[model samples]
Target: MKIVKEALAGTLESSDLMVRVAPSPEGALDVVINSEVMRQFGAQIEKVVRETLERLSVTEGLIVIEDKGALDCAIRARVQTAILRAVENPVLEWSALS
Candidate 1:
């Protein structure tokens, strides 16, 4: 997805990471993160993801992210991208991709 690529190249700061956002037809968003970076900014990542979701207003689905060493900016951007991608296209799987 363009958003994810942009996030990785433009926003992801610490290291390479994988991000996914799956939205249910109901418009609910579920977010998940796992990685070394998470050990540091787990809570912040969740907040950013949730906030992004709230902004997107997706009703339902799972948003999963596999962060290697991405910074908060990276996570935020990726989450935004993933959410958009998920909403636009339904082919992507919303799971922790490593």
Candidate 2:
């Protein structure tokens, strides 16, 4: 899905995370992540984000992840939510998300 505009999901509260997505002017995916557990889970968080984006066929966007010790599932959900919000006339295919 293409990011047509800026969108946000989730929150910065503990055990939760915030995802921000916007169109990339450079036509490339740019991801930034900040997490309370970065020392131990930073790579995992980045991997989850990248895999989620790939599954959604996201090619170009600026994604920012703010994590407060959220689980991988939460990260995926937040990213999916933000992507849906950022797309125009989004048509979600539930099976594809699996």
Candidate 3:
């Protein structure tokens, strides 16, 4: 699914994160991440984001992640929610999301 509009999900509080997504003018995936745990978990967080996007078949978009030490599951859920909202009426494939 392609992102057609700007969308956001999640929060900035401790143990949570915020996900922001938008259509990319560059026609490629652009991801930016800012996290409190960057010193220790940046790579893992990036890995999760990339994998999630790939699973959803999202190849082009701007994804901004603001992390506050959230777990992997929360990150995945937030990314999925932002993508779904950005698509603006997604036809979700339940199996792929798993």
Clashes of each: 8, 0, 0
User: In model 3, which range of ten residues has the least summed lDDT?
Assistant: 88-97
Deviation in angstroms for 46 in model 2? 0.5
TM-score of 1: 0.61
How much lDDT does candidate 1 score?
A: 0.57
lDDT ranking, high to low: 3, 2, 1
Ranking by TM-score: 2, 3, 1
- Model 3: CA > 4 A from native: none
What lDDT does candidate 2 reach at residue 33?
A: 97
lDDT of residue 35 for candidate 2: 94
Candidate 1, residues 1-98: lDDT per residue as tens digits?
Answer: 21222122123345756775543455445566777756678887778667655655544676677777766666666665555554435344344221
Residue lDDT tens for model 3, 33-91: 99999989999999999999999999999999999999999999999999999996798
All candidates' lDDT scores? 0.57, 0.95, 0.96
Badly placed stretches (over 4 Å) of model 1 are 1-14, 25-28, 89-98
Residue 6 lDDT, candidate 2, scale 0-100:
100
- Measured against the true structure, the TM-scores of the candidates, in listed sequence, are 0.61, 0.97, 0.97
Best model per lDDT: 3
Better of 1 and 2 by lDDT: 2
